[model samples]
Target: MNSLIRYQVEDGLALITLARPPVNALGQTLRAAVLDACQRAASDASVRAIILHGDGKLFSAGADISEFGSAASFAAPSLPDLLSRLTQLDKPLIAALSGLALGGGLELALACGYRIGEPSLRLGLPEISLGLLPGAGGTQRLPRLIGVAPALDMMISGLPIDANRALELGLLDRLAASADTLVEAARAFALDLLGDLAPARPQTPFAEPAASVAEDFFQQYRQTHEPRWKNRLAPRLVLAAVEAACVLPLQAGLERELALFKQAEDSAQSAALRHLFFAEREAGRIPGIAEDIALRPVARVAVIGAGTMGGGIAMNFANAGIPVVVLEQKSEALERGLANVRRNYESSVSRGKLNAEQLEQRMQLLVGTLDYADIADADLVIEAVFEKLEIKQQVFRTLDEVCKPGAILASNTSSLDVDAIAAVTRRPQDVIGLHFFSPANVMRLLEVVRARETAPDVLATTLRLAKRIGKVAVVSGVCFGFIGNRMLEPYNREAHRLVLEGATPARVDGVLTDLGLNMGALTMTDLAGIDVNFLVRDSNRSAFADDASYYRVGDALYSLGRYGQKTGRGFYLYEGRQRRDDDEVVALAERLASELQVERRLIGDAEIHDRCLFMLINEGIQLLDEGIALRAGDIDLVWTNGYGFPAWVGGPLHYAEQLGLDKVLDGIHRYRDSLGTYGQRWFQPAPLLERLVAAGKTRIEKI
Candidate 1:
């Protein structure tokens, strides 16, 4: 018997326990063991039924993702073959699910005659997020149990449902009181089904939906979601598999689903999405910290300044069940900030995202305060005050006087120097940058800026805390804009220069959107507030003054008080919230072109895409070489999570690898020669990029 699977037969019942530690991911070894267990169960004369249960916290987290695209995944006793063997067993089989039974785990359960789940179990087929569908009979078996529409929605959304919902959907045969009792409950459930029928014959026959209704549903789903998926083929392939299940016999549908799965698995989209999946997990790892490093407990959190950023930051702790004290200088500002938080929660309730009770519970965790003394006991104090050095210094100095000795001090600064901010406080080790993007609670990315004097424990605790709040935390050495915004500087600068060189705002934005970006640089600038970018540029004037045309369009917009969506005019005019092309803005761009002595000329979409994207990719190469980012994967995670970089593109670094370093370097040189001094200044290839090309390296990992 394999150690991963413990099998025993007693009282006419065979028990097969998946004893793998952590998540019992369905790997080749585990699959082989499972198949052997089924064969042994079938041979035992005393065994009337079999129960399958995992020994650890979860049944499984699904397929061992590391095995994907590897030879091991296709080895003997593969998941599909093992599941087929289980289906062919003479004895009845019951799947005892607990914690998480997702993807392949869920598929395994579907293959069983019965499924008994813990009440708190999380169940789903979430392979869609990784740009693949549940390949192992999920497409065929799921719709056979649940209705076609619900099954399609579940797989399409790639979200997990609780045990109660799973039971309601006819996915679970029974629900156990708790995970601890799930195995016993499965045995009890199996007793009722003993000697019922042969294992090859399923209890519930596959039901085909009406052709008209099924066709309508599939067509509607495709028409509505195909555009959003952009260039990706996984979603469309998933839809095709589910459609096959509705029309074909079980065996035929399974074969068709297998074909589609193989197609999706081989696509570049799947590979890139898989890269990001691993990158997100890898971002949490730090260089010096041990896995067992003690983390500081953050039970109470204090957020200074109840503005938009502060209020959002407070919600993160409040949602995590930590008490938060939101401090503001004035009562009116405090009330206003609290009101916005309430409205945000209320909006979520209206959207069916949060229950009223949950909203109340989270709001109760928040305490509005005007006194520093009120937050003296906070375990963590974060200042989301005005983005000025002196303003932040004063807040930290006050915190130094009031906060307890061991409290963590974090600044939510996007571009400011963490070392400079740490100088104001006595405890520099505790003063780290917890840079949360705007609408902090909603954004998944959190750059945990490690300062020069930051303690290892501080970083360890912050990384742990970020996970608690459902964030993807990537560590960075402190610098202007850290990682995401630092690279974004050149990317945005090129967008502005493109407009001045005669590309319309609509054309520039259209080019990027066609390249699979969520929005164009000009569109994002308008949404982020044009005046905000102007201020960021204004503060860094000394560093950027050598280039006269640096954000000339932004300076002109700021001078005209055209502050984007807020002011209803920036790069484009706005009606309510929708943007419209403004002739005035276009005329302004032409004026800047004349002032800069650059002839206004037509630019192709390919050039627009390459110039902007390649510039961003080059900067990421520079950051990796400077050690500002720990790894190339870290840069990928930062851009994909923090900025709106498309996950399918893998991120600037990974995308550069796909485009080839030699091609990127050649394009940069061409731009430098064509545009003279300005292009020479901005488009000089990073040393790392040149070296990677010289060495004939193709991947970002090689660099």
Candidate 2:
């Protein structure tokens, strides 16, 4: 491996460059060498000022994720040790940040007396996403420098802010034209800091209220907000750190922050969250993919439908500056879809994410047509028709007749045999799937389904396009809902089964909500239209009234005309569009339970969360066993990005590790005993699960 740190002193300034390619992730050797360099700079008599910078694509992509779950000591002075040394040195310290300065990178920048960055630099402290708080001086120094409110917002949300925004907020002292020139600007800035009036650490106490920012900000915000935190770990833990900084001295505050950080890093919640993060990136890979598969650039795209999903898919292409030709079945639906597109653009303009001119530019990029002839010039054609296989076949047949040679044909099918859809055309190699979640324009996930006949280049082009549209492309093997919804079937099945086993819809929903899913499976069904899942389920003999042990509570709700938020009703009733708990629904569940002669027990909240989640983990293992998913990490990504699994929990596999596989298998067996034979297949442990159970392994990748 290449060395990460190098130090040089000249012209009264010392420069320390983190030279790790890609990102200077704090791996074993880098950690030790960087700390050694920091010490050398501190001891050098000729060094008047210090500058820390990174080489290659980014400042750093935080800690080397590969080093996670290991007990390797930092092998260098701790962040606190280095930071405290920086402050005491007679020389000023300047941090030159470029690209992304995230996690430990942000913490490192906070320790410096000054920060300068390129206009494109993206800065963030995203420990919250990993189930930890900043363990370095960030918790103590950031609030004091930037005020508590903004710091709390940045810390809690973990969203990266662009450099211009950082400059406005005083997170950066100046901006450069490009990332490569940042070091030159930092050298100049450091020279300016070489005087009696050089920049000094702020002496203000953390509690000194900025008339505009104070404790009341959080107090007031929480009052009007429903307790929406998925769990008490991240949000509450972060708030406590911020408060400690407000009152304690810097040394004590840092100590307090470190203690909290340790607690979280070792916590099951943090482990789960970390697993989810790795799982998402893992989703991008496919087994047996040739490294030579070349991605063709997609400058123009065409869509064959104009429903909500179609319109949204069109928006993705147009918004990314790819010209679009939307082909609908009729002029009226085309007109309606085009009108909705305009409304969406105007709404975004109103919200200031776009300007009037930009909206016009995006609209200019989009075109609507009623004829298949318009698609001949497109680089790609996506079929976003209804979920019926016949409809997709007809669209593919039309595209086969009309599209230019080598044009990639794709389907936005959530669940259906994509290979069968590809078979409708002579050029099956050009066809693939890009399964966007509901409200396609808003969700950050895209399931890139790969059929066996699909050309690698076509799959590669689709993956690149997915990233361009701001979606995480998790490559998936063909199955119902591919990886995400396929695993979700068993999960949703169990939730419905619980209702008949004595739990109510409310109880099940609450348990999931508490566990950190965006909503309970039942409520999510309501939002997605209670009938939508049936479209997925009705395929492949898994539909309701089947002898399979599958359960779908929403099926009954839909049969009763409760079609979710759009119909103003679902598993729960709604007042107008607002969801309200329904006593009638609860009473109906009771009636069904009575007819089944089932016993209702006082199930604890933790048990409900674990049981529902473990079912998915079991299926994830099976998917891996069947090679529907390449790895455990791929399944994790599917759950994290598409299924609203909490990011900090790391994903289902990581969460299972924290719970211990033996414990999870034990629970599955317990549930099997009560749920019966169908439960045996649905809840049975995978071979890997069995191995982990036998070995008593608490986490994967530790060995």
Candidate 3:
């Protein structure tokens, strides 16, 4: 027997265990071993039945993702071929599942005659997330087993269902009463099947389609999901593959699934999604931080300030079941902050996302106070106070004086220098930037800024804590605005400049929305508050080039007290959450153009898309060359998670690579030549981009 496979026979049952430690990822070598084991069990007269299980924890996570796009992935017996052979076995085959059975793992389970799982089982075909449908008979076999609608939901959403839900959906034959008894239960179940002389049951036979599934069911699913699925190829192809199962025979359906899988695999959208799948995992690994580094225990957390950002930051800890103390300067502010947290929880309860008991339990974990001494024992202190540098430094000094030894000191400054804040602390090694986005509790991204003197353990601990709080944390070197916001400066500059040169706010935003961003740049500014953004720009005024027309319209709006959604006016007028274009804003832009001697002309959607996105991409390359971002993918993660960059086009850097580095370079030169001084100053191509283009390299990570 192969070392990767543990084969044994007991009581006339051949037990085949996949012994790949960690996730039992199905690779070529493991696939070959599994095939040999199954063939051996089928031929042996003494083995009346066979049971397949993984060595530990999980049945399998899926195929070896690292082997994807490599020649090894297609080496026979491929997953589809091996599964096809499994269905032909004369003896009954049973899959005993535990933990996760995802993608190819669940597809393997579906090929078995019967599947019995532990109560901890989680099953799904999540290939759609990587921009590809399941290639190994999943699309065809699943719909036949579970019917069309449920199978479509499972494949398209790429979300896992628990053991109870799987059992209820008829995806599992039976679940073991407890996780510890899974193997024993499977053995007994196999014995019972052998005693009854049961024939091998395959999922090839299809019953009549579900009554709810109409002839136009797939079309309706597409129409309803098109907005979310726009620019995404895999989800639409998944729908096609599932529809094939309903009309075609088993063999024909499997062939159609394979064809669709190959098509999706070759698409740029899938390639981008696959790149991101690896990038998100790679973002966690720091060069100097070893995997075994001891992490600080964060039993209690403290937040300074009682404003919206502070309250939201506190809720994150409370929701994660950690005790949190929120400090405010006055009694009234502290009460209001605590009340806001309650309202947020109450809103969750209303949405059926949290129960009444959960709401009270989370709220109970939050304690509001007015004294810094009250948070002296906190393991982690995050100051979400005012954005001023002096204010943050003062808060850090107080935290350094009061907090216990080994406590982490974090600042929630979006664009300020983390090193400057750390310089005020006695324990600079403990100081780090935990820049959470607005509505901190709701945003998925967390930028972890590491100062020059930051210890490896401190960085590692913050990354671990970020995961615990359900945030996609990306480590960034210290710089003004860090990763996300620093790149945003150039992107926003072009949007503001485009409006001055002729584009309206609505048109500028519409072009971006059409390109698949969550919203347009102008709309995002309005949502973030024009006055707030103007203030941020003013604080960083030294960084901007000497241009008279730079964001002048925004400055004008701020002067007019047009503060956006909160005030119902800014770049556009707001009616509640809905917004409409304002002719006055356009008039203001034209007036600025005339006073600043800037020529306003017809701006097409193409220029609007290219100028904003390409500048963003250029700034990202500059960040990469400057070492503010460790890898190109880290920059991509920051944009996709934090700034609403579409995943289908990948992040800006990856999208640039897809569009060809040479073309991006050419676009920069073209803008520089046409826009004269303004373009020459801002559109200068980064050295890294120029070098990559000269070298004819398509991948940004080559450096």
**TM-score (all chains, Cα) for each model:** 0.98, 0.89, 0.97
The whole-model C-alpha lDDT of candidate 3 against the native structure comes to 0.90
How far out, in Å, is residue 315 in model 2?
A: 2.0
Per-residue lDDT tens digits for candidate 2, residues 282-346, read 66566666656778768889988988989999998888888999888799999999899889999
Write model 1 residue lDDT over 1-703, tens digit each, in one string: 8999999877788999998778999999898888889888889888888888888778877898888888887688878777877777767888999999999999999888788899889998999888999899898888888878888888888999999999988898799988787777887778767645545335563476434254577777888889888977778888999899888998899889988888888888888999999988888878778989988889899999899999999999998999999999999999999999999999999999999999999999999999999999999999999988889999999999999989999999998999999989899999999999988979999999999999999999999999999999999998888999899899999999989999999999999888788889999999999889988877788777889785898899999999899998989989987889999988999988898897789999988988899899988888888888998999999988888888888888888878788999999999998988888888889898898888888876535
Model 2: lDDT equals 0.78
By TM-score, the better pick of 2 and 3 is 3
- In candidate 2, what residue range of length 10 has the lowest lDDT sum? 203-212
TM for candidate 3 is 0.97
Off by over 4 Å in 1: 195-201, 210-215, 701-703
Best by lDDT: 3
Q: Scored by Cα lDDT, where does model 1 land?
A: 0.88
- What are the Cα lDDT values of the candidates? 0.88, 0.78, 0.90
Total clashing pairs in model 1: 0
RMSD of 3: 1.8
